[model samples]
Target: MRPFNFEKVNSGAEASAAKSQNKQFVAGGTNLVDLMKKNITQPDILIDITKALSNTIEHQNKGVTIGAMASNTKVATDKKILRDFPLLAKAILAGASPQIRNMASSAGNLLQRTRCPYFYDVTMPCNKRKPNSGCSAIEGENRMSAVAGYNNQCVAVHPSDFCVGLSA
Candidate 1:
């Protein structure tokens, strides 16, 4: 693990101003922190957005407004989100096992790294991990690779079955 600087800012303005060249907004570091520890992600500044401006599910106009920081479990279990936006609910349910969904957020889920085993191991050469690294999954264990919308470079399938169901 590498030694890095850490601090907490109170307001949105302060947080935005604190953004450095390598600074990243971290909300529910369920994924980012792990990558950092694994030496996959290295950031100079980590602005924790666990509690900042907006972090709640709201219904103001016609449709629903899903805050980036709202927990996936809450959205998956919320009557309103489930009833109105089953797509969102289904997506959440299909993601990150039950434990991860409980701690992950919608925005974070959208940005979660690929589940390709090759990608997980930093030592392995993966196009997604290192652009033009020459895809290994193409000729490797492709059963777990994509069943649709996959090309030669990367054949890894998206693990989110919920995303598929939610689209319908």
Candidate 2:
């Protein structure tokens, strides 16, 4: 793993300022840290957004305005979220394991990458992980690939059970 510089940001503006061509937004780092360790993601600087974003879950007239940094566990178990959106709660439960849910943020979960094998293998060519690279799985083993919403470029499925529940 590469030893990279870390910057503690206090606000979105600070985060934006700290960001660079080689910098990445480090929120939960549940996925980023692991990817970095694997050298799949090489960020020169990680702008920590955990402290910057408000983690409060507030009730609004329409619904609830969940903060960007609010953890999945909090969102899944929130009384208002569970009661008003049972499907969302169940979907969150069905998605990631308990430990991941505790640390992963709702915003991060919503921005998760596809669970495609090609995307995982650094050697294989994947368009989602690397834009314009021809998809190798277009004719390869694709029992898990998307069929309904797939395009000619990529057949990767957005793996988000909570997203599906939220949409429903």
Candidate 3:
């Protein structure tokens, strides 16, 4: 991973205020860390938002509020979540491993990047990684590419089971 400056903030406003030219907000560091390791992303600044965000699952009159920093495991295992959003619970439980679910935040899951092989492989051509570089998945191996709402430029899809559950 490339060397970068780090900052820890205590609120969403603080995180937003600290955003630099090439800054990324990191909470669980689940997806972002892997991308960083692969050199897929090279942010100049990493704002640690773990402390700034709430992890609690709050019960409200209309519905439950899940904190952006709430872990997938916490959302999956929460009494109210399990009772109210079983599909979401199941989706979260089905993703990654126990350790990953324990660290993957709900907001991070929603904001996670594509799982396209072309996008991950730095040596490969990917429009998402580099605009107008050409999309390898269009003519190359595309088993994991999107089935709908795709163009010639890209066929990448966001691989998040939690987001699918959330949609329903």
TM-score of each: 0.82, 0.90, 0.93
User: Which candidate tops lDDT?
Assistant: 3
lDDT of 2 at 134: 75
Angstrom error at residue 109, model 1:
0.9
The regions of model 1 sitting more than 4 angstroms off are 60-62, 157-166
Clashing pairs in 1: 146-157
Root-mean-square deviation per candidate: 2.6, 1.8, 1.5
Answer with 1 or 2, whichever has the higher TM-score: 2
Residues forming the 10-long window of minimal summed lDDT in candidate 2? 112-121
On TM-score, the leading prediction is 3
Is 1 or 3 the stronger prediction by lDDT?
A: 3
- Cα lDDT of candidate 1 equals 0.74
The residue-level lDDT of candidate 2 at 9 comes to 90
Give lDDT for model 2: 0.83
- Candidate 3: clashing residue pairs, number: 0
Candidate ordering by lDDT (highest first): 3, 2, 1
Decreasing TM-score order of the candidates: 3, 2, 1
Candidate 2 lDDT by residue in tens digits, 28-133: 8787887788688888988889998888999877678888899989988999888888888899888888998888887787887675667777788888878998
Question: Compared with the true structure, what per-residue lDDT tens digits does model 3 show for residues 1-168?
Answer: 989999999988998899878999998889999899999999998999999988999987768999989999999999988888899999889877999998899999999987587788899888888999998988887844787768878899887878878888
